[model samples]
Target: MIIKIFSLNLRMQGKKTYQEKLFACFSLSERVPKDNFYRQLGGVLDLEYLYGLTRAYYGTSGQESVDPVVFFKLCLVGYLENIISDRKLISHCSMRMDILYFIGYDIDDELPWHSTISRTRQLFPESLFEEVFTKVLALCISKGMVSGHTQAIDSAPVKANASMDSLELKVPKEDLESHLQKIRHISRMDKPHRQAKENKASKTQQTIDANKQELGAIKSRNKNWSKNQDQRPGAGNKGSKYTSNKTHYSPTDPDARISVKLRQSEKTQLYESAKCRHCPPCHHRYSSLPCR
Candidate 1:
């Protein structure tokens, strides 16, 4: 009788597992070079100015608030790193030694919870953020990185999430007093822009003429409502391409406007035409019936 035996082939396999390390030398600052960009930023930026701006929001009797400077630094890290999600920003910062050093945190220090970042963001006024932005911009200008001259703006098309079929005719402005009031109220509730407007009123007014020109262009386009079906690029489907904001408006959203590519070439104006001789029903060429 032959016996069949199974032997396990287990030597040493590298598998992922969790283990507690009894000892380790951890120094975040030591790991990060002195010439690192974050370190350089920390050295150059004097964030103590923020404490005065943020002081009124904190109570003297309550538990300590997150350091205003550190909070802003964390926000800057998120912006520079392009980490839009708050949770991911915190996670990313936690993993980077340079960031920890920049934030003045020790290796073992636990970063503030993501919710804290959100709450702190809400608590601060927009002026504070603007102040930070202006300071950084001025610094960049001084460093010759950004020219404080004429700046050009650009945009790309983003398909709307809402359906075009839900569009409705716009109500006349004279009939929208209540609607306008509601919109103003909603705008007031959005603290950031409101506060920024209050703080930088003069700067905003300086661009009024430019804004008016843009508005006038939009108004002209809305009024004209040119047919651009043949001119629109990548128009694989057949239909009208341009719709006027004046003639058709989306009642579902006051801000929604139909946009089309305005740039066109003479080639885009190509039209298809056909001509054919009319034949009689009896298969003779145009016999007597006016020969249309």
Candidate 2:
């Protein structure tokens, strides 16, 4: 109700900031003591508290003027808000009223430039993100926001980090099978999209070689199993002319399965023998999880 009530005198002041308006929305700047709202929002999160926690955990060495917390917070702010691209995120903080306010900046405050963001990220490892994330989640638990209960257990299609088009498949069902066929066709075409992406040559070469190696490993495993097995356990889960990626990559073409097995595990793995695109292939030699 308070958010809908705009206090901006556009005729003179142009507009009140989203941050300011947001604070007003929660009555953060009102007669209620700062402690009351601060308490309600949770706990004190001063610069020292932020920096100390990060400094102790990150264990970085050397002299630096900028606080590590600012860098960490910037990263948190970026990802949590679903602003995935760094450059676009920087641009938002610079121009967007709501972002600047949330990050403790004034309406006309100068936010970090895109280059600053690029440079700051170089200082922290990927672990820093996970560390800070867990801390936040713990706080949610402390506030009784999460139960870690089985009822809370759920699954959603986490699209492969691979482009959506890269996941195309085709089926003979002619009914809805045509839709899958289009997906498969599209994914095949999208392969070159990643190639055009100006990725580092070394990284690209490494990825290509890694995939090739994985394909070989999968082929070898499948060959040995086929020679010994009367039937594959996963084979029972298959539909006519459609093998489930739920366990392995069954291309629209059946022969492709001989060389490339797609194991779609809940472990977030995508193993394609055709190209070695493995999503954290389970490192278990005997982990009872079936191979396609």
Best by lDDT: 1
Per-prediction backbone clash count: 0, 10
Name model 1 segments beyond 4 Å from true.
1-21, 149-154, 158-168, 173-244, 247-257, 260-292
Instruction: TM-score for candidate 1, please give it.
Output: 0.54
Candidate 1 worst ten-residue window by lDDT: 192-201
> What lDDT does candidate 1 reach at residue 141?
66
Candidate 2 has its poorest 10 consecutive residues by lDDT at 251-260
- 123 in model 2: Cα distance from truth in Å? 1.9
Best by TM-score: 1
Cα-based lDDT for every prediction: 0.58, 0.43
Model 1 per-residue lDDT tens digits across residues 1-292 = 1232222333344589998899988777678898899998888887788888788889879777789999999989997897988999999988888999999988789999999999999998888789888987787668766542333333544444333443332323433555334333322232211121122213222122325565566445433332332322222323434333443343333343455444732111211222333332444443323321
Q: What is the lDDT of candidate 2?
A: 0.43
Tell me the lDDT of candidate 1: 0.58
Which residue runs does candidate 2 get wrong by more than 4 Å?
Answer: 1-47, 53-66, 95-98, 150-292
Candidate 2 C-alpha lDDT tens digits along 139-202: 7678666544322122333223332212122222223444344333332331331222332223
